[model samples]
Target: MSDASVPKDRRFPIGLTIATLVAFVILCGLGVWQLKRLAWKQDLLARIEVLKTAPARPLATVLAGKGDASWTRVSVTCAPGQAETLPLVYGVRDGDIVWRATAICRTSAAGYGAILLDLGVVKALTGQPTPAPLALAAPTQAVGVLMAPKSLGGDRAATVARFAADKPAPYILMVESATPAPAGITPAPLPAEISNRHLEYALTWFGLAVTLLFIYAAMLWRKMRS
Candidate 1:
C-alpha cells in the first residue's frame, strides 16, 4: 500500500493508547507498592530480632502499667489456682469437636499480674470435658513472653468480653507456647518477639506508584511512534 494509505487514525489509536497508559500506570503503582512493603517488612523483622535477643524486662516496665505497646517476650511461672483454665471453641473438626484450653496466669506483682497461656487443644466425645489442672503454686518462676492483650472488637466482641469478665486481671500475656509448664514453673529462656508489618504495607504502595509511572511512560512512547 502507498504511504498515504497506511491509515494513520490518530483519534482511535491515541484514545486506546491513553487508556492503556492509565491502566498500566495504576497496576505498576500497585506492584511498586508491594515492593516497598517488602522492604518495610524486612526492617520490621530486623527490629524483632533485636528485641528477641535483648534482656528480659518486667511487664510493668515495658507497658508502664498502661495498655499500650504490643509484641514482647518474657518469662513467668504458672501459679496454682492463680491460673484459670478456660476452653476456647475453635469449631468442629471431622465429627468430633475440638477446643483449646487456655490458662490465665497471675504474677507476684500487684496490678501488674496476669498472662494468658494456651495449653493445648482437646477433642471431645460429647459434652465439653474439663481440662487437666496445672500443679504449680504462686511464686513459682515460669518464664514467658510479654504480649499485648488480644483485641476483641468487631464480630467476636461478645464472646471475648464474656471470658475477660470471668477471668482475673492479666498483666502480660504469652501466646502459642510450645509446651505447658507446671504451675509456679519458670521459663528457662525468654520467648520470641515480632514487629508490626505496617511499614511493609506502606512501601508496597510506594513501589506500585513508581512502577505505574514507568509503564505509563512506555505506553506514551509507543503511542507517539504509532
Candidate 2:
C-alpha cells in the first residue's frame, strides 16, 4: 500500500545540486594535491636523514656544485669581519618570538664568497622587538648544515641586499657548533624529526568529501519521498 516511486510533483534542486557538485570537486582536488605533497615531503625527509649522517664536507665543495648542498653538513672556518654589527631576522623559537642573528663571515677559501651564518636566536631581547645587532667578537670554526634562508623565514633578497657592497654566498649555514661559541647565542641545530602529515590531511579532506556526498544523497532521497 506504500508508493515506492519518487514523487513526480517534487521539483529537483538544480542550484543546490550544482553547488554540491562544485564543492565535491574542490574537496577531491585538495585531497589529490595533498597526496602529491606527501610524496615530495617523503623524498625531502629521506635526503635530510642521509645528509645528517654523512661526514661533513667543505662548504666550498657544495657551493661550487661539486656536491649536493641542500641540507648537507659542511664545515667552514669563519673569520670575524670588520662589520661591528650583524643582521637580525625576525622569527619564532620554541613558541616564543625571537630574533635570529645572522652574520657574513669571511672564508679564506678560493672562489667562494663570504658565508652567511645563522647564529641562532638572541638570548636576551630585553623587550626590544627588533633587537640591536650583536657583535661577532671571535672567529668561529663552524660545523653545520647549509640551508636556504627563505625556508627559515629569511628574506633571501633582503639578506643579499644587506651585503650588496660585499659578495655573499648563495646559501646560509645553520650553525650547529662553533669552536669558540658566540656569547649569548644558542645553536639552533637541525631538527631530528621533520613532521610529515600530508597523508593525514589528504585522508581528512577525502573523508569530508565522501561525507558531503552521503549527506546530499540522503537529503535528495528525503526530498524525493516527500
Candidate 3:
C-alpha cells in the first residue's frame, strides 16, 4: 500500500505507543515485586533455621500466656495418657495413623493450659488389632514447632465434620517423637531456609521491560520513516 493510503493520524500511533509502554512498565514492576518477595521469604527461612537450632524453650514461655500464640516451637515431655486422650486426626501416612495431642499442664506462670503434640504415625500389626486406646506413656520428651490454630469457619466446619468427627483443636506441632512404631512414622525434615530466586525473577522482569522499550522504539522509527 502507498504511504499516502495509510491513515496519518498521530492519535492512533501515539495512543498505541503509550499503552505498550504502560504494559511494559507494569510487567517490569511486577517482576521486581516478585524479587522483593523472594528476598523476604529467604530471610524468613533463615530466621526459622536459627529458631530450629536454638535450645527448645518451654511451650508456655513461647505462648506468652496467650491462647492465640500457637506457632512457636518448643520441647516437652509427653505425659502418660490413654489413647482416647488423643485429639482429632489431621493426616495419615503409609498406612499409619497420626493424632493431635493437646496436653494440659501447669505452666511456670501458675496456670493450667493445653499444648499440642504431634503423635508420630502408628500402624496396626498383622496379628494385633489397631490399638483401640493408643495409650501414650508420660515422661517422654518431645520437640515440636508451634503454629497458629487453624480457623475453620462455619462452612468449613460442616465440611470437615463429615470426615473428622471431632472438633478441630488449636495449633499444629511438627514433632520428633520417641514412640515405637513401624517404619515411615517419622515426619520429613523441614526445608532449608533461603530464597534466592527473587533476584532471578527481578532480572527477568527488568530485561522484559528493556526489551519492550526497544521494540516500541523500533516500531516508532519505522512508522516515522514511512
Per-residue lDDT over 149-183 for candidate 1, one digit per residue giving the tens place of the 0 to 100 score: 34311122232344454343343343333334343
Clashes of 2: 0
TM-score for each of the candidates: 0.49, 0.81, 0.59
Residue 1 CA displacement from its true place in model 3, Å: 23
Count of backbone clashes, every candidate in sequence: 37, 0, 9
Ranking by TM-score: 2, 3, 1
Candidate 3 TM-score over all chains jointly: 0.59
Q: Give every collision pair in model 3.
A: 70-147, 71-146, 71-147, 72-146, 73-146, 78-140, 79-138, 80-138, 83-134
Per-model C-alpha RMSD = 8.2, 4.4, 7.5
| Candidate 3 lDDT over residue span 1-226, tens digit each | 7757777842248687879879897988888798778877786667576776677677556545645544356765545554434333343333534433232221232132334444444433222334343444322556666554353111223322332323223444556543432143444223222336777788888888889888888888887776
In terms of TM-score, the best-performing candidate is 2
- Candidate 2 regions exceeding 4 Å error are 1-9, 66-68, 108-112, 126-130, 137-140, 191-193
Please give the distance, in angstroms, between residue 190's alpha carbon in candidate 1 and its true position after superposition.
11
- Which lDDT values do the candidates have, in the order given? 0.47, 0.76, 0.51
Give the winner by TM-score: 2 or 3: 2
Q: Could you tell me how far off, in angstroms, the CA of residue 205 lies in candidate 2 after the best superposition? A: 0.3
lDDT of 3: 0.51
